[model samples]
Target chain A: MDEAAIDVRGLSKSFGGRTVVNSIDIRVPKGRIFGFLGPNGSGKTTTIRMLCGLLTPDGGEGTCLGMDFRTQAEKIKEKVGYMTQKFSFWEDLTIRENLEFVANVFCMNRVSERVEKALKGLGLESRADQLAGALSGGWKQRLALAACILHEPEILLLDEPTAGVDPKARREFWDELYRLSEAGLTVLVSTHYMDEAERCHEIVYIAYGDLMAKGSVEEVIAKTKLKTFRVGGKNAAKVREALEGNPAVATTALFGEDLHVSGTDGEALKRLIAPQASENGLSLDEVPTSLEDAFIYYMNRAKEN
Target chain B: MFSRQRIKGLIKKEFIQLKRDRPTLVMIVMIPVVQLLLFGYAVNTDPKYLPASVILRDDTFLTRSIVSALERSEYFRIAGAVFSDNAGDARLRSGKDMFVITFPDGFTADVVRGKAPSVLIEADASDPTSVSGALGALQGIAESVIAKELKGPLADLAAVRPPFSFTVQKKYNPEGFTRYNIVPGLIGMVLIFTGVMMTAMALTRERERGTMENLLSMPARPFEIMVGKICPFIFIGFFQSGVILFLARFLFGIPVLGSGGVLAAALLLFITCNLLLGYLISTAAKNQTQALQMSIFVLLPSLMLTGFMFPFYGMPEWAQYLGSCIPLTYFLRIVRAVMLKGAGFADVAPNFWSLTAFVAIITLITMKAYKKTLD
Candidate 1:
């Protein structure tokens, strides 16, 4: 991380007396894909909007692309691309027309060439004449990405860009993102998918209005301090039930015949579940805490606080 | 295949959704209440106090009695006296007076000698229905007043061929066709329909479809977006205006008497005013449905109070003031004056300026209402 592309502090936003994002600080280095993860209404979208100048923070100070995000919003808007969670493009316009409209809005030079390049780059050239509304969810997401990058923005702020896409399409979308990132574009993307989050260089997890966790994928899991054990047995539900009542277990889930139990204190959780595992003639194996489990631990801890 | 429980659940859901839409709920209650008040309080078919300007070359007792009797009849208000017949004609052309009653010179001596002098009564008959009732009342008023004045000797004079004669000349529309008045005013109506209602729904559709958020997130300024959105509708409004003007000219045979440039300029100003007002409505409305409801709310007043359907001066003073505040009122005036009286730019300049002011005011308010941020 040589220099921060997006460096923000005390970024807070509220809607109608309800605080959506509060005092959230984020710093993403240039040319890095920073994942923003949160449950629904966790202010992931709110924070992104504030950074892009689509929303003014109730209380905050930050810089996006080295310009004051608040006061220099117009100038910053020139360099930053924002993709909303919804398909917020003109559906009536064809794919080519939509791109052309966006290119015109940005007042880009050589708009036709730029549009043709974006269409081909997004694999939309074959169906560029189709109305945007007629496209499937996966293709719509791709088109949104193409439109966002049409102006050659330095930073891309995507709010859940792949929320409803098929797995294959999502994989392709991420491949495009990687290409953009490698080409020196800093990306701040919000998503609910854990697999997508793991692909990011670093991630920040927000719960409700607070920043719960922030680090690289492994570092975030390490920060959670959660220990997980895989118990394989026919009595997996029984094992899960017993661990659910105990404070030592942060989260417990049954994956087929195997039960995965996790908690912050490794010693206490092992001590608590070891007897139960042997009593039921179950094999227990310690496993690294997955990001999903770490996130659940953060959520549970936030709820308790 | 419809289950009772499912139907009941759907009905409940619909009601809940409707209740949650506060703007629609408010519109539901306000539309009828306001409509009732407007129809009951403001609308009048047989308009009273039709302003009449007079040029009395014979201001004798008989002529004065005739003028006072016209006022007492309550059909005419007797606005003010003018020195010449040209001034009276000017008042009629400008729509300031509905009638111009002129008493010729030496009318008292001629009447006493049973000369049966001619009294010229010029009526602005562009809006035939509005002036018809007052015009019908004039002869009775003058004859009765003259009969009262020519008492002893005039009883004999009244006995034969009437004491005096008055010729009622209907100006602008000698044929007195109602279509002439309505067809010209239809230009403003069609403009309102497209410019206000359609423009409002178009903007709200963008917001509802979520395209507006995307547009706002771009490098586009609010003013640029507003202009781009409204410019297409402006063309649509002009197209509708052209259609109406074509129909008015061919179908209704309503003469396009004014300069084409003047009418086009007025149409541009009027259409822009309506489109800006629509933008203002869209800024206030949360969705397309609310935008439509608000458009109807604004439209009903323009239709009723702008002298489009009803006589403007016939409404109560407060309603007249309210009507004046609507751009359609000035538009109707300008269009009618231009089409019927062949008025020039100077004739309709006040109305053109009023519409311009409306555009300016609505533009400022819409700018304030339009939030650059989603907040």
Candidate 2:
């Protein structure tokens, strides 16, 4: 087993008498791409911010890169690259200038060489002189990532790195993350996209200041113990709508033309859906619980608690 | 406590941004020029070339000499001669002339006989400061003229001081040009605006644009960030001081009597203090608009209580204490003393040290208060 890159216990934070992050423990192994999944306002960004020393956690005790996260933040900052959820590079600065600035901030030598390499790596050499504010969303994300890796940081804490990007751009961005991870860099990325979450080596789901689930994608799904059944018929929508009001059914989500109904109690869910299934004349096939179904199950379960 | 490389990067970035910001660049150059011209030609507290009329009932050589001296004194321009007291009084009442110089009958004879008759000079004393300097000049002119006329056998009478003949030797600004006071003080005002407003906006703009979080997450320390951000404006402050001093010298005839090195050193300290204050303000403000609003809290007290607009000593005791806390009050004193009074380093050492202490204290506070994290 690899050593943990970020191992913190009882991490907590609050703002203005409202708890944003409860006492949550997180541990990501070195050289792994750890996914942080949560709905909006679920403190995913806050947790990422705290890890990179952009914000001070209200309560926590642990080490990042073998140093105390609280007392040795400055040391941690030297080795950590934090890409904010927002495009936080200077908008008025050109792409090359922005990269150069980051290099200088890290006090790296051969600034022009490094900036040029970053520009080329981003495939933005032709547009190096363009202002960052003028770039499209995907290009801006690339610039931000390029800036983050300029210093060759050991750990990358990305907060929703591809939030507003198109799917193709997002795919390319995840590929870059995987490449960085393969190079032995620890990556802790927070995202809302199911495909993105499924690509992670492991994922943690947090909701309402609580860590609901944490494991590999399949492990998280199995932990939910949700028995999901897929049904496709003329009355699929009617069955989905009818199962939503049933207490036995945990969650119902429509994927394309098919409906996925999930529940923690397999027998009770089957018993409740069989009658509706017969009435709608739709055949039900047991299916593996997907990451989205597991997440929705966790979200609903968290809301109940 | 600071890294040279990070500071250099911050300074370079700031310079580029400052260059691109056209309005701020224009303000940087235009503030000193516009303020100097506005205050130089327009705002004069000491009114000169005031109109006056002579009521010469006992016209003699002494009286004529005194009247001519008054005209040459440039404090008053003789509008005309009046035969009756009513006409002179009416002229003063109507504001046609600022003063009515009345020579009582046998005034010269009484002086010659050593009877000590008084020359009645009635002045319109409304708006006292406007007339105070001219009235004071009148005393000097009248005494000298009488002494010149009372000669030979009358030398003894001249030797004896006249009834109102206590001389006030106005030092430094003998003419009491208001620009002499104002022009030097403008150096402090210009620096306060540029140093405080520009630097106050520096960090706030970064935070507002969401760049501050990324910047903080870098290896650069707050000290490096603060110093780097403020270093570029130090040159702007020097350029502004140069502009104001140049205009003060050639345009308004104000002297740069102190040592250039001493003035420069003192100015450097004052400018650093103001910039540090602005940096401190930036730490507290959240956006550009908030920075601007916060800067006014500093600039207003600087303008009003720092002896810029009103006399520093004239403020109430508590207000004076409040004024003393402001760095500009010391800077205004230092700049004025250095420019007008030819004060050397030793002469202005106290004020210079006050600004030094201000720099030290504010630097400590700002660095301590500067947030390394968003918390």
Candidate 3:
């Protein structure tokens, strides 16, 4: 096992007396893409900010890039490349100018060459002289990524990097992240997209300021202990309506033409679906529990408590 | 230790953005020129052509000569003639005339007999500045005109000077050119405008644009950021002051009598103080609008109470005390003393130290207010 790149305990933050990030712990090994999965305002952004030293946690003790996260935040900042949730670079400046400014701030040697390399690496060489504000959302995200990694820090903390970005751009962005991770850079990205979350080596789910789940995609789904019964028929919606109120059913979601009913108690789920299975023109089949279903089940359970 | 390279980088970035922002750049230069021209032509302490009505009871040549002489003095423009004292007072009260000159019913025989007839002059003194210079000129005009009128047989009366005589010599501004007073004070005004407003918006703009979080997440220190943000505007302040000073010297013919080194030193200190005060405002403001409001909030009091608009010593003791607290008040004194009064470094040392203290205090407060982390 490798040493954890980010190891923190009991991290919490509150804004105006309302806890935005409760006491949560996380540990991610080096060279892994860790995805932060949660609903909006679920402390994903706040936790990412805290981990990268952009924000001070009200209560937390941790190490980032092998330095004390609280007292040695500046030291940690030097080793971490943090890309904000918004396009935070100077919009009026050209792409080359923005990258050059970032490189200069880090006081890197051979700044022009480094900026040129970053521009070329991000496929922004053609638009190097274009103003950042003039770029489309996809181009802006690419430019932001290029600027953040100019110093080549050992850790990358990205806050919703692909938001509002097209699917093609997002796929290309993930491909770049994978390349960075393969080069021994630890990556922690906060995102709401399930596909993006699934691309991560490990994932942590948070809700209402609490850590609901944490593990690999398979491990997280297995831990949910959810048995999902896919119901397909002319009256699949009717089957969803029948099984919704049962104590065995945690969540019932319609996924285009099919209904996925899931619950934690497998025996109860099976017993409830058996009667539905015997109904005319109705068929029930057990399917592999997906990350989305497990997440929904966890979200519903958290809401219930 | 602060990173000089990072500070340089920040300044470079600022200049590039400033080049791109054409409107703000235009404002930076145009505001001072517009203010200079506006205040230069519009503000005059020595008001002329004030409306006056004369009440003549004697209808003597002497009264007519006095009225015409008053008109020729350019201080009084005869609006009309009033028949009674009541009408004269009505004209004064109704804002129709600024002054009422009344000649008593005593005939010209009194002046011919060397009895020294008294002519009463009533002036509206509501706005003291508008009336002060004209009123002061009345005594000289009366003496000269009466002396000239008493010729030949009245030459003895002309020879007899007034019971008490006094001469007023305006040493620095002999002609009472308001530009001489306003142009130097404008340096302070322009500095405050650019220094406070520009620096006030710098950090808040970053925060509003979401770049502040990225800035803080880097390895830069607060001191470095503060210096970087403020250093570029120091040049801007100098650029504005340079334009104003050039105009003051070449265009307005106002002299810079003090040592150039001392004036530059004072200006440097004053500009830094205002820029730091602006930075302090930025740390407290959440956005650019609030920052601009805060800058204006500071500007209003400084402009009103700093003796830039009115005489500093003429203000009440408490207002003077309040004015003394504003950096612009001291800077106005320093710049005016240097440029207008021909003051030396030693003469303006107290104000120099006061501005330095202001810079120190504001820098400390700004640093304390600028938190490294988002709380």
Top candidate by DockQ:
1
Per-residue alpha-carbon lDDT of model 3 for B1-375, expressed as tens digits? 999999999999999988986556655776576456434543444756778898888897777887888888877789889899878765554334667887777747777666667777776543345456666887878777766776777677666654212222233455666667678888898889889998999888999889899999999989999999999988988889999888878998887887899889988899999999999999988888778767876786687677687654344456657778899988886787667656677666777888988988888888889988877
**Candidate 1 residue-wise lDDT, B1-375, digit = tens:** 889999999999999999898888898899899899999999988888889998999888888988889899888899989999778877788788889999999988898888888888898889998988887886788678866787775678877777787789999999998888898898999889778887787667888888878887888887887898789887888888888888787878887898889999998899888988888888888888889889998999999999999989788889999999999999998899999999888777888888989999999898888889877
Order of models, best TM-score first: 1, 2, 3
Candidate 2, residues A1-305, lDDT tens digits: the string is 77999999989999999999999999999999999999899999889888888788999899899999988999999899999999999999999889988899899999999898888898999999999999999999999998898899999999999988999999999899999999999999998899999999999999989999899999999898889998877768888877767787888988777888988898988888888888888888899999898888788778888
Give a tens-digit lDDT track for model 2, residues B1-375: 899999999999999988987656665676577456434543345656677788888888877887888888877778889999878755654335657877778877888887777767676543244456677786778677866777788888866667323223334565656677778888989998889999999899899888888898898988899889989999999999999888888999887887788889988999999999999999987778767866876686677666677555334456667788999888776676667656667666777778989999999999888998888
Q: Give native contacts recovered, as a fraction, per prediction.
A: 0.89, 0.95, 0.89
Residue A70 miss distance in model 2 (angstroms): 1.0
TM-score of each: 0.96, 0.78, 0.77
Candidate 1 off by > 4 Å: B1-20, B152-156
Worst 10 residues of 3 chain B by lDDT: B162-171
Show model 3 residue runs off by greater than 4 Å: B1-164
Q: Relative to the unseen true structure, what is the C-alpha lDDT of residue A100 in candidate 3, on a scale of 0 to 100?
A: 85
Error of 2 at A275 (Å): 3.1
Model 2: CA > 4 A from native = B1-164
Residue pairs with backbone overlap in model 1: none
What are the interface RMSDs of all the models? 0.8, 0.8, 0.8
lDDT of model 2 at residue A177?
93
